[model samples]
Each structure stands twice: as C-alpha cells, then as structure tokens.
Target chain A: MNDDALPPARAIEFWFDFGSNYSYLSMMRIEALATARNVRIVWRPFLLGPVFRQLGFENSPFVLQKEKGAYVWKDMERQCRKYGVALTRPSTFPRAALLALRVALYGANEPWIGAYCRKIMQLNFADDREIGLPEVVSEALGSLDLPAQHIIETAQSDANKLHLREQTEAAIRRGIFGAPTFFVGDEMFWGNDRLDDALDYCEAMSRRDR
Target chain B: MNDDALPPARAIEFWFDFGSNYSYLSMMRIEALATARNVRIVWRPFLLGPVFRQLGFENSPFVLQKEKGAYVWKDMERQCRKYGVALTRPSTFPRAALLALRVALYGANEPWIGAYCRKIMQLNFADDREIGLPEVVSEALGSLDLPAQHIIETAQSDANKLHLREQTEAAIRRGIFGAPTFFVGDEMFWGNDRLDDALDYCEAMSRRDR
Candidate 1:
C-alpha cells in the first residue's frame, strides 16, 4: 500500500487534572495543534489526588522537590505568557479534583469537553480560584450555559465514581504516574508539552502501516 | 536590623549534566536568577550516563516512556520558541558529556564558567554539532581566548575524575535520580526550570533571617 493512501493518524487521549498548571497550557493549545496536525483529541480528566496518594506522594511532586516546585511556577508563567493565557498561582493546590473529574467523565462524549476543561483550568490557575469550591465550579458551569445541577448530580453518582476509579487504575497499569498524560495507540506520553510529539508519532505510525 | 542589611541566603548546589537539554536551559538562566535573589549557585557537573546505566535506563526517562518522549520533544520546542533560544533535535543523543563536564568543573572558579556552558549548549543543540568532538570544544575555548589544552588536561586528570565520581555519589545519596537537580539548604528541587523558585526561597530566607 502506498503511504499516501494510508489512513490518517488516530486521535490522541489527553488525561489531565484541574490542578495541573501544565495541563492548562496543553488544553489551551491541544485544539489548535490537533487541527493543524489533522488529529482528534479526547479529553480525559482524572483526580491526581488519588494517583499521588497511590504513588506515596503527599503533595505535588514540585512541592516535595523544591527546585521542581520553583520551576513549575516560573515555567507555568512562561508558558502562559507565550500562549496568551492568563495564569496566577492557585492559593490552594491539589484541590479536590473528584467532582471535576466526574463531571468530565460524564461529559466525555460531549463536544463541550474541551471548553469546559479550559474554563476549569482558568478558574483554578488564571483566577487563582479554588476549584474544589462548589460556587466557583458552579460559576464556571453557568458561564458555559451548562446545566450545573444535572452535571453535578450526575458527576456525584456512584456509577461515575466507580468509572473514574477504574480509569485511574487503568492509567497506573499503563505505567502512568503523573497528570497531563497522553496516549497514542499503546504509547503513553506523560506531561502536557508532549502533545505535538505524540501526534507526530501517531502520524508516523499510520503512514508506516499504509 | 534592616532587611537590606541581612546576610545572603544560603547557597544552593545545582547538579547538572551538560548533555541534558533541560539542564542547559537552567544553567543559562540560574545565575541571573541567583543574583536577583541574592543567592549563590554552586554548579556541579556529573555524568548522567553512568547514573542511567545504574538505574537500568538506556536513555532519557522520556525515551524509556514513549508518551513522555514525545511530549518532551514538543514541549522543548515550545520552550525554545518562548525563550528565543535556537534549537533543533540533536541527531544523536546522550553525547559523551564527560569532557565537556570536566571542562565546566575546571572553569567553575573562573568567570568564564557561564560563557563556556552557554557556548557548549549552543554548539550542541542550536548548531546541531558534536559537542564531544575535541576540535569543537577547542574552538569553543579559543573563542573565549582560554587555554584549551590546559583546561582539557586538567579535566582528564585523576583528581577531576575522582571529584566527578564523588559528586555523582553524593547526588545519589541525596535522592537525585535525574539531571538539573538543585539543593537549597535542606530542600531539593529537580529540573532546570525550578531555578527561579529556588532563588525565591533563598530571598525569603534572607528576609526572615533579618
């Protein structure tokens, strides 16, 4: 088969947390990048809290490692400036991401996933707001013209919670120990900045298969 | 006592590998950050190749994890564009950094230390040349009007080799598993980007001591 006749690259899976500053940068850019590369993106939000706990981390890796923490803030600033995104250090980090993740899981099939993610990240980092606060989240949902009551109610359901838990376990099984992970085929790329390279690899694989 | 009259913050030791792309970014920027925050930066050059081998990694953590590798390359590109640093992926990675690191160690006490590091990184990443090449290194030294022979001879000396080894051992003992690690007082920060926060912590400490 001619390479030119091959199917285009498969969609990318982006797993992220609301508390991750780098996730904000990736989410903000993933659309444009996907469009440019002609690849689809699946937004997957998961609570990093459980992941960190399971990995024996009491806090963000940055906080546990001083230099890493310092760089994370500065790097976040740099990325935000470059992307024309507003970012401020959140007052509380590692905020309860459960509700947000649940909302995302239920909305996974919806077209509003990308916009909701961008808004939540901005609410946490750009506005320095507590994502765990119901008011703050409700405000974000209201802005999106989303049914805040329905989404929140569905997100808190036992079924969705179990699904989110199972997904986290799956991520761990796949060797993921961090937030902002991406997957192309069976390859797992951790961190937000890797989106483009993930897309490239997928494209390459598709071409090769053809 | 006035805050302005306080002693400088305790120095931070930065362990880096010249061959590390992220380390290059930190090395180039840490000095300015240190100066601004009234903190001293002690540059430590060690061999990561040996460390990786010991850890059973054949290459960078990114490469060992496919998803991470993709993100790192793309993220690096974005960072380079943001920092106005010219960069292209090196054709060969994990270049023999021993010679370059030795030279860096030899020049640690000299004023040319920063300039030497910047030039070497530029040559390797920006210019896409073999930094391990003796001629390339000599040219870099020549440009600085330094005695390339003397530096090279010193770097290859038994004493320097022992020092490098000792430093690597010290890093391992300190829980360092990667390049661009920094230690400020008892706090450890890993990765080049954390330099700013390291400096900030130093400044805050200085203020508190007053």
Candidate 2:
C-alpha cells in the first residue's frame, strides 16, 4: 500500500512496572519481538503498588507467597539462562522503582523509551543496582543521550506525577492486576510467557483488518 | 539400543489439582504432547486447598484477589479458545475435588490415570458438571471401563485418603504453590503455559543422560 493509503499500524499496549522482575524480562525483549512482527509498541508505565493493594495485599504477591517467591527467583535464573540474558539476584526484592517509573512515564511515547526501559531493567535485574536512587535513573537516562537532569525534573513535576497516578488508575480500570500485561485492543495477556501470544494476536488482528 | 541395554524412558512429573482450571488445560493436552515426544508422564495428584492455606490464604488466591479472579476467568476463555478447547465456565469455581483427587491419587501409577484425570477435568471445566459428587467421579471411571464402585471404595479407603494428604504435603515441601506444576527432576515448572517447557526440559535432560 502507498504511504498515504496504508492502514493503521498494529499496536500492542505494554503495561509494565520497572520493579517487577517479570516486567524486566518483557521490557528487555518486547522491542525486538514487536519489530520483527511489524507491530507498534505502546509503552504504558504504571505502578503495581496500587494494583497489588486493590488485590488485597500491601506487598508484592511474591513476598506474601514465600514458596512461590523462592520459585520465582529460581525460575528467573532458568529463564534468563534459556534466553541467554544476564540476571543477578537483587539484594532487595522489588527495589524502589518510583523514580524510574516516573522517568519512564515521561518518556513513554518518546523514541528512547525502549532503550531507557531496558537499561533500568538491566540495572535492577541484571546488574542488581539500586534503581531507586535519582542518580541511578539519571545514569540510565544519560546513557540514552537524553537530557538526564532536565528529564528527571520534568518527571518529578506535579503534572507528570499526576499523569503517572492516572496511568496506574487506568491500568486498574483496564483489568490489569499484574505487570507485564499486554493488550491487543481489549484482549489482555499477562506475564512474560504470553509475550509471543500477544504479538501473534496483534499480527493476526492486523491481517484480518487488512 | 537393545531392550535390555536401552536407557530408562524420559519422564516428567505432572503435579495437578482436579479443581484447578489451569490444571484442566494441562490435563486435556499433556498426554498427546508427551506421547509425541516419547516422554512419560508421572501423574501426581495433589490438593491446592492446603497449599493455599500454607501460602497464608484459606481460599484460592483467585478468590482472595477479586480483580485477578475476574482476569483469570476471562484469560481462561481466551486461552481455551487459543488452544481450541471447549470451556464452559463452571457454576462453581474450584469445585471440591477431594474425592476425585483421592481417586486420581489411587490410580497415580496406573495406565488409565491420564484418561481418568482428563475426564474429571472435562466435567469440571468443560461440562460444568459437579465433579465433587461421587456419581460424577464414578461416571468418569465407568467411561474408562474401570471398576467404578470398587475404585470408589478403594479411593475412599483410609489408606488412600492418607496417601492423598501426604502427597499434598509433599507438594508443599517441593515449593509447589500452584497447580499444573511439572518437574523434570528438581526443576519445577508451574502453570499450563510451562507444560511444553517442562517436557522439553525432560527430553533435554534425558538426552544429556544418554
């Protein structure tokens, strides 16, 4: 099809929280996968804390379910190995991702969003770096050749903070109870394992529309 | 290799609960998948009730997490559609599977275990039948040409009941917090989505041993 007459690009809305290990897995790989399938990625940065609270827990389900928590770390190790990626056990499970998430929200539609998210995920999950610190987030942004300090200030602005909160609220309204959730229209797929299914669904929908 | 010189068959330990919808998904398909790969399935029937209690919930986590519970049912519909399986949302979620589990446990090592498990799962997830009823359990066994009443009697025996309880405790000790878990030795893979991964792991391990 000619550029002017081309149909709208297929898009998958990716809802993720930087603190979530599983989200780390999806964030590190979704870009390449979506690109291969010619699907657009709509980055949705949100906090899982509110969602978890609504689900009747003050902490991450992993922290509440001790055995499952242990299983997750082991599973992550095996999964990272299978994917040929790096994973280090973070000293703090669910390390503070508030600043990182805000930064992500600020860059949600920006071209650098994917690389920025991968860097933050790598810092938290692969390098086990303390990503809660402003400097760590700044470093991740700086590596992206973005205006780190200015972006951080913008992210911390009242309007941006409200935007992040509203985004998380929207996630809850959209039936998102966990991070690494993907949406091809209203079809929701949870977990990193469903990443492929989500993209496949998106591609199929685009084909059917065409 | 000659029969006497042949290595032991590759096996995957399938730990499932009769009441688990996800387990139902796995039960419906694991047989053909295992057969195609020449992987033996060692059925391990266990109760998720006690496991949930151990995880600090008296009910299924789905019941405890309202949003997640809703998400699960919807996700189940999508997943069943994707797998081309029939799914009728049961009248009661997590229908009591005590007797069914006991029966499955009694037949854990028997050749008909797979068929018996699938029948019970179909009753609960596909037909919306009350699997908790003895007659329902009997019907499943009868379809397999098994001695329905006799199997029921044996399944209810104090010894079989105790075995079922012990098996659940074993599941807890093995870091199993959910149903439809698979193990290729000490490596545990949880959920229906991990079925293929578990089988692959089993096959790979067997190859390495060979």
DockQ of 1: 0.09
TM-score for chain B of each model, two decimals: 0.90, 0.94
Candidate 1: tens digits of C-alpha lDDT, residues A110-158 = 8888888888888888787778877777788899999998999888889
True contacts kept of each: 0.00, 0.93
Q: Which window of ten consecutive residues has the lowest lDDT sum in model 2 chain A?
A: A1-10
Pairs in clash, predicted candidate 1: A67-B189, A71-B193, A71-B194, A188-B67, A189-B67, A189-B68, A194-B71
**Alpha-carbon shift of residue B168 in model 2 (angstroms):** 1.3
> TM-scores of the models, in the given order?
0.60, 0.93
B1-210, model 2: which lDDT tens digit per residue?
Answer: 111122244888888988899998899999999999999888889889998888778898788777779889988998999888899999998888899999998888799998899899998999999999999999999999999999999999998888888888888888888988988777889999889888888888888989
Q: Best-fitting candidate, measured by lDDT?
A: 2
The ten-residue window of minimal lDDT in model 1 chain A covers A1-10
| Candidate 2: residue A175 Cα off by (Å) | 2.1
Name the best candidate (by DockQ). Answer: 2
Interface RMSD of each: 6.7, 1.2
Q: All models: lDDT?
A: 0.75, 0.87
Docking level for model 2 = medium
